[model samples]
Target: MSLSDKIKSNPSFKKIAHWLMIPTGQHRPRLWIRMIVNPFKHKRGKNSIIRYRTRLDVFPYNHFDLGERSVIEDFSTINNGVGDVFIGDRTIIGMGNVVIGPVKIGNDVMFAQNVAVSGLNHGYKDVTTPPSVQKVETAQITIGDNVWIGANSVITAGVTLGKHVIIGGGSVVTKSIPDYSVAVGNPAKVVKKYNFETNNWEKA
Candidate 1:
């Protein structure tokens, strides 16, 4: 069975695991206890703050991959072993987001609420085979500098988001995006080019 199936099948074990993770003699405010109880064992980074109300489901981390000054806010779920997720400096993974890794996110990036960043997909090459029954394919997701991923967006595997790309809320980014474009909707499309009318961004 998959890891997810194992978690479902042994709810008691899961509860026990949470109970075991409680740090002794650490004074956390009552409001923040549940959120601080259990975090993925492999998660490590400098100054990575997961707030009081957040929930990271079963995520793993690469210790060498740093999350410098990053904030994973409340109600987010980072799922079990896909691979390592590297969040760069000054990144904000907002509330209610889910990230399954093998993803390298760049500096100053913001992922809004309910955003999903996944690095795995199901394969279905055989005509007679259903996609759900097929083996899973894995890839890496790379986000460039100064990108803004809006609320409720889903970024699939093997995709690279260029610098300064603004993905609108509720977008489904299946493919790669170019630099400085504003994309929106399911199967996100570039709707407008970034025009600097106020000398904020100069044309290249």
Candidate 2:
């Protein structure tokens, strides 16, 4: 049987698992506790840390993949929503962040507090129908290695961020950003680019 089927078959087991993950507010639960509880519904690598009060969506558990030593801080929510979510090694998802898949984030990524990343958008093509009832449109969001997303940033669907990119605080990323670029503002625009010859970041 599928993992979801198993969990459905034994509701008590699911309840017990959630109970074990209750936050203590002191520190992250032990690795063993996380392993046993397995709230994300997927296998996570060593030293994975989910801080106190963080919430993970349960439906698409098997679709989530967290690499080694990744830390998701308090109040963060990761929702798979029938799509794949991959967080690479040593990535830090700061407090109150919401990450929705299909999204692939590479190694050493840092997302500041309250960052929102999502790959699915609600469609509102038919004026007669309620927006909520409309079909969902989905596309993959890919963030390459060494990306640092500042606080309160929103990364929308189908956006690709290249390696060594930096996004300023409160920015809204609606399109792909090139490697070694620093982007800021609503509908984020490249403000700086890394100069290979000078080894400095220069205004774009």
Cα lDDT tens digits, model 1, 24-138, are 3422223233345223344446787878776544422232244778888898866445567777888898999988777888999999899999987878897799997787788
TM-score of each: 0.68, 0.80
Error of 1 at 81 (Å): 0.7
- Badly placed stretches (over 4 Å) of model 2 are 1-41, 60-62
Local distance difference test, each candidate: 0.74, 0.86
The TM-score of predicted model 1 comes to: 0.68
Clashing pairs in 2: none
Work out candidate 1's RMSD over C-alphas.
Answer: 8.7
lDDT of 2 by residue, 152-178 (tens): 999999999999999999999999999
